[model samples]
Target chain A: MANHAISACAPDASIESYIRHYAQCIDISLKQALASSNAHPKLLEAMEYSLMAGGKRLRPILMIAAAESLGAELERIMPVACAVEMIHSYSLVHDDLPAMDDDDYRRGKLTNHKVYGEAMAILAGDGLLTHAFYMATLAAGSDAVSLQRLMLVIREMAALAGIAGMVAGQAADMEGEQGITSLEQLESIHLRKTGDLIVFALRAGGRLSGASEAQLKALESYGYGIGLAFQIQDDILDITGDPAKTGKAANSDERAGKVTYPYFLGMDESRRKMHELTESAKQAVQQAGLPDPQRLLQLADYLMQRDR
Target chain B: MANHAISACAPDASIESYIRHYAQCIDISLKQALASSNAHPKLLEAMEYSLMAGGKRLRPILMIAAAESLGAELERIMPVACAVEMIHSYSLVHDDLPAMDDDDYRRGKLTNHKVYGEAMAILAGDGLLTHAFYMATLAAGSDAVSLQRLMLVIREMAALAGIAGMVAGQAADMEGEQGITSLEQLESIHLRKTGDLIVFALRAGGRLSGASEAQLKALESYGYGIGLAFQIQDDILDITGDPAKTGKAANSDERAGKVTYPYFLGMDESRRKMHELTESAKQAVQQAGLPDPQRLLQLADYLMQRDR
Candidate 1:
């Protein structure tokens, strides 16, 4: 399952092909990165287990598409794109740990902890997170990407993925369980938790491509819109998505008493908000004057209509 | 104990003074880095709890000393120095988790997990690790350090501190619990676990300072010698040192049925190896033609005699 197509397509074969093309490249780059690690074989196996357990590959795709849209060469930015996915994978691995979400399965397969045991799973997560930086730093080795720009990318990754961004969101999400009072609170949490990384992927791609200040801001706007919309869809899917397709138990969020978009806004309102954000995301990219904004525009639409 | 003197000083007052001066600078830089993070209040507290619970500040001090010895500006490399310490702290935090070493105390204070709970502690460690890259990448923002050099530093960091180095060591250490190992095997494990980071610190410092390849090689040689010697001392200390001074239970390694240098080589031989390695480290620096080798030489001697 991890080696096969991750997304259930949205009827547009071209967009599906586009994603497949980029994801395959990402998968290869990811494997190469792991191969060069020279890590303990058991540890390497644990890392590969979770990292290869594919999902949408959304983050890396977003990064690649954003970079390509700005005329950045595929080979130059692929490392950073894959690095984002590594960060995402590590978070998922840690989230599935017994102390956190304690999920038994992810993507229709055993979670890293389920397969590797707790200690190795923890180290695996640590390995992925640490190596993500290594992958991104590799971009610096290339003359095409300036050191200052690569530094910005590394700083952005660290800032957005660290305590100030995704980690903070996880912390808030956990604390909010004691009391989730309103939609605003939930949105606040998701913004840092989910939105920041999306923002990082888009901005890092743009930055690596030498995008202007105005263009970088535009990517941030698009990232925020899609980031929120994506999470809302995830919440909606928890209730409506099929277990076989989504690779998750039905209504797992509700079962865990997790506060989500639907929990606060209701399904009807949640769907409306998701569409609104998706449209805004498309508009942000369309208006950004990028040489190739078609893929990003389509991605927003595809994300809006995704079933899994 | 965490805030006060971390080292039981050597007989030479000058070496002690050198360490104190550098340690104070490292403390301030580390605080400043964390202060600017703007993480969640609670998360910040958790991170601060572990970070501020200081030990010898050995890694950062080593980085700073190595850089300073080569005429690199302290301000230029201080961020990198603090970054290494953050990585070390994160390793300790994660290592002390119930799923890992399950320790209750460190540096004579409650462990991060003991105080912050398992989940928060995990994030805290994650936070520190991610932030370390942010701090190291900051060196690129300075004009004093060239991007190419800084790029090498970042690459070395991710390589040695990530899966290829520290994480590999940690994985081996955990797996080694299954059986008593030979001296060569024990040394191999400690070399990756401890020596790699030490090597990274020295080489990164050298790279940032525009050290020649021969100089960097010398640093690596010095790092390997002291790294093994340091671990040997730790094992010997487990049996002979005071809990009050060491801040750890006496003979905890033996209690855990862990293999150590002394376990294979015996106390006298272990002590002999430590002194031999220390002398070799001192000789490496003395022969490197560093403009200032006094501090590094003294440090090797200081580390050889540290009680904690």
Candidate 2:
């Protein structure tokens, strides 16, 4: 009964429209979540500064699309979607701190610490990260997902984003800043830092939407393929894309002496690798037997073709 | 049937022995949790440095005692207990950061950033915080606690420990360091910072133990009373306790010019308030219809008299 209802409601909109629609929905949810916080105005300001800053809302959109493609109601998964975006925003805030990336700007504007001071920015990031669990748990109230499923989502999300996953990847990346230049090392770092959370987002959607085992396997493959492709594109953009388009300083990776896919694989090979990954991602979606896999396929192509 | 079984097995050990036993159990769980993580040895090292550096495992111990007082199985609640301690440890790591309290040492050892560098210390804190939710969700597997109940615990724990609670209090405290001194403001900060999580620990135990509504309410009152008393005692100790015994510099709060109960109410009055709070805590616990409330009462008295 649940599967039948979900299949019947599979997204009928175009991929672009689907993304835009869900992005707006997620933005509203994020806004509502933050708006209820009035205890610390400055902390909230710092959090909102980064959270509300314009971006593609990619993580949450991916989560929504992943679920909706399986015919699950997007509304039932908004809390989880918002939570992922919150996690992503918190990571960016911390990454741009003086002790880390030390960037002054993000998303074409001043970074959180640049605007809120280091202490407030750190607290803002902490606030976002902690609140994210609260937000994700909100999904337990939805009729579309069971309590057991939400618990699994919480556990999986934590593992993916915690010590053994994103945090581990981040630690390695920071340690690597002293000049580890191997492609395998960089890929290892990227897999944890970038891939795990992205993969978890899709898997969470599948888990919540009750996707079949085969469908989940396909989503995992799709997630890994696009996660790698996304990082490669980011590296390529750092070297070749315009600052205006990318919303970041062009060639900054080279300036920082950071190892990147382009540097390790060479630009031609990097582009080819990204293309192959994108193809694999599209194929994974195709083979998943989703009622409507159009949005995911187009999303992969869009990610690949993006200049930013 | 559950209530009958729990009441039959209520703890008969002395408070000291009870606490010692549960503390050892919590330490073992914490060690096993960290031991399983092989990724980023340095980050784990930094986390372990603080986690194992040793203070009384007050939060987790409180949780264990709370459950045991009601005759609930302590093993069934260990995950939530360990998670609370993890949250406490993470907060300490971040609080000691150069950007925050700028403390050089904690628990008589070098702070995380001092030993692991600023970036790795930050990641270690993040890793612990994120891992906490993962740990708490492990409670879902226990037959003693239903999945829905565990979800509620996660949500409540996150809220109490997250933005609107500890983080908000820390932010306020940080902002207050610039010279806001008032008893009300101090209490407000202490209530959110110290009180909420302590209250949460007790309530989570109660919830998992299936305490009646009246018992949970009594626990809340007991928690707030002890929480306030705990902070007041801490303030008093900072001014008068020996640094060797306290494991932190005596009079550091005074030197930092941070506001404290003693600062606003005088040392004698602070002592009076601490005694009052402790009495209130004991009274609340006694009023609670717990199977064995002696441990909680003794714990309150112990907290009030502790030099460290």
Candidate 3:
């Protein structure tokens, strides 16, 4: 029934198809813009290496999907989609910097600063982040309403990516590794560090589409639920996920001594929470009266089930 | 004659008055928006400390003056002006970070990392630099010309502030400490690093003012000349500047084995070159037919002659 409702509204487009299309929108611009600062061939090559490496492209797709449900034009959402992905790419690059996470191999590829050398990696991240706005400016070209929407979207991205959001979470994550973490502390750390950006991604898309006030409010609630659901699923997968499909070591998170939902709650309890969060997310979307909830339902299911 | 030109324009606004007027034009809206994102007040405070610190406000004032010259409204220039200042502030903060110059002070005050700790300082700089564009969007509103101008101004600023410009220059400077730089190499680094930003500042103002294409060309020339002149003055001051006036150690450049024009050409030749650059800059503005070149002329002369 859920799939029937979703398909009726966004008929003929598979969730996978939409995600692939969104990724294409992001990669075309991301690769072109960060490629050159002053015709430096090597820096572009390195940025391409990290950026092209297959991560989920989850944030960008979320932004686009949310925007679509609100009736935003494709052009309007592309920039915000690209911007969120760029921010994600930048975080990954910096996390691999010498002063930070430092282990280097990410998504089963050599880390950015490691492959490109430390200095180029740092500049690559800076260039990518700066260029994201250059891309987002495209959205500003549409209308004041659109531009205002873009501004809010980017503000949310920057805040999540900056001190209060990603950076703070990263700091807390770093601190947690040196000691044991209480469940509450761990949740607090993850909320800002990871959850916030994902939430922004969902809500920004809705904003771009000019979703009705009621719709926007509901999407926000949906975003909060799914953002946590996504993280919780990752925690579960870290413990029991298939390495072949996930392309990562199943127990890597545990080995790292990192705090996770699974670490705080037993695996069984974590599973229960994930299911509840996914249901909660679906309810929020339903409450919003989305014309098509099929893909969104699929997304929620994927979030609750996926190992990676 | 100089006094007559100065008097012919509006009465002498003290530096404080000039700086404050520029400040009034800078948007606080973006800052207000980000205020609530704080997980800790210290990070925000550290960011504000450097961002809000008293300086000549040279870059922003240039942008505003350019806007005014073109008959562009104050509202139109505010975002770009703030963006430029944010870039400047980030550079200062990072330049004082542990991996870079490692100074504990800047502008005669405790440096950002000093007050906030290294990690927070780094994050603060990154945050301000990235958030600059979000602020620019708010200022841009719906004017395509203004928006286009914003992009142009931002691209130029990025080129100046990034690896091809200031940051890259810093890299070469630190790396070349053990080596003797030929005059050409020293000039290249300075032109790209320090000169790039100053030139960008001038161009930003010119673009915002809706200057004619020919006028922009002329302003470019103005930027190049003043930028070089400004650096030469610094080289001269490093040798004989009052430590009190500079709020820095006398002859610190020499002690640090920095590459400087004066270091290469000696005091007499450097002064002669600075005079030539200053003359060219003045001629460029004059040829542009600005009704009031007095402030700009005074500005050029002040930069070339400042003891600090």
Candidate 4:
């Protein structure tokens, strides 16, 4: 359900097509939702800044991939994909808030507050996050299982985003901001703060399409691997990757003295671990025997390739 | 399903017992929810300060009253009553933030920030508010109509609390904080900021137990007048109520230049309006001719009569 796919690449399908379709569905729906909040110009402005910000649309891609694996139709799958992205975007916005990470820039643009001020930025995150559930309900339509799945995913995301997941992770983050922490502590913090939502997104997509329990289990394995690998690559890139590609300050994590995988395991070991994690994720996807696993495998590769 | 049967003068339930029962339900559930955030000590403390601070549980009381009107069992109604209070408490914490109202004291104790700092206070509010829906879902059970009804109230509350309702109202309040305005502007602000939630609690309770359309319509009418009256009385209380009972500094609204009902309408007229509104609400309840309008009518009277 969440594993990386490992089939030979489709002869005709391009990543561009996948990107364009996912983007169009999400952008249109997201803007419509943002517009509904238009009466509060400041809040809407801040939301637009974050929601429309450039990214690979990775979380939504994972959703679309999972849905496609189940032979679900485009219309049936689009809403869940968009909803997952909304949650992701919201997490980024709040994580970057003044009280949290407080980065003034993200993806080469002024961060939400840098563009819209702190209060509006806060409200924008709140609005987008809450609206994600609102969007998910539309997908439920007449399907009882879909409704329950959507509700469960929303509940899971909420838990991850609130005290149990992101916030607790953040509390540890802020506490550890002063210095390096144990590798176990850092991993625990990252697993919830950053990893939880991504895993939830993958499994939620599988749930949406009624993927078999066997397939779903594989997806969870894939999700776990990719999620941890994603963090490792992020740790590696923070110190080594080109800032221009990353859209963040070079060595920002190092200067912040953040306890990343690289900091705990050292650069060499961390890089090896990242590759191992990616391989593990790809293997999970292969074992799942998804009809087509190329994009999922390519996505794992893409995670390692990304500078940011 | 929220209306309670309070008989200050009679047997099965007295005002003291009714208020105590509702208050205990709200307090105990709130404390449990707050305890979950104990992983973050400061957050737990911040939530405790505002959540546990003494204030008459008016919203819960309203919810119970409406539930009683629809003949729902008391134990079954407790969760929603607690959820409504959480919504109310979250709004209060956010409102008292430095970026919002910037208050230093509430209930004559240090505000959330004074005790726990700003970021923790913000997170605490976010945690409590997000948890409200989770609590709501528990009480809603598996009944489709019940779930939908609960979601309807929640969506409305979210709107009110977000940019559209409470946040919008709060923005208007913030904008109006330093300015002078007429009675209409003051009334409008309070209507959304406070009145909307109260309306939801009352009507939602009625709807929860499947109240008649005619009965609901009457409840709405009762809600409308009293909602306004409640705020007007609040404004009046700021000037005249016992500070200890009010849990805020005497004349605090005036001191903040809050452009409250009393200030806008003038003291004498505001008091007169409150009485008129209460009477109208009482009359609406009376006209509805339910099996038990005693609680509703008495609540109307009590809303006007309570100086603190």
Best by lDDT: 1
Docking class of 2: medium
lDDT at B305, model 2: 86
True contacts kept of each: 0.73, 0.76, 0.23, 0.22
Error of 3 at B91 (Å): 1.9
Candidate 3 per-residue C-alpha lDDT over A77-170 given as tens digits, one digit per residue, 9 for 90 to 100:
6666777787788778877766667676887888986776665666567656665655665566544455456656666666667767776776
Compute the lDDT of residue A17 as modeled in candidate 3.
72
Interface RMSD of each: 2.1, 2.6, 3.6, 2.9
lDDT (10s digit) by residue, model 3, range B66-146? 555555555556666667777778778866766667788777899887887666676677777766654555555455555
**DockQ, all models:** 0.62, 0.61, 0.30, 0.36
True lDDT of residue B186, candidate 3: 76
B204-270 per-residue lDDT for model 4 (tens digits)? 6777767777887788778878989888888888898887788767887767656777666689998
Q: How does residue A79 of candidate 4 score in lDDT?
A: 55
> DockQ-based ranking, best first?
1, 2, 4, 3
TM-score of each: 0.94, 0.94, 0.84, 0.88
CAPRI tier of model 4? acceptable
Q: In terms of TM-score, how similar is model 2 to the real structure?
A: 0.94
Q: How close to the true structure is residue A257 of candidate 3, measured as C-alpha lDDT?
A: 66
Please state the CAPRI-style docking class of candidate 3.
acceptable
Off by over 4 Å in 2: A1-13, A141-145, B1-12, B142-145
| Residue-level error in angstroms, candidate 4, position A260 | 1.9
Best by DockQ: 1
Q: What lDDT is reached at residue A71 by model 4?
A: 61
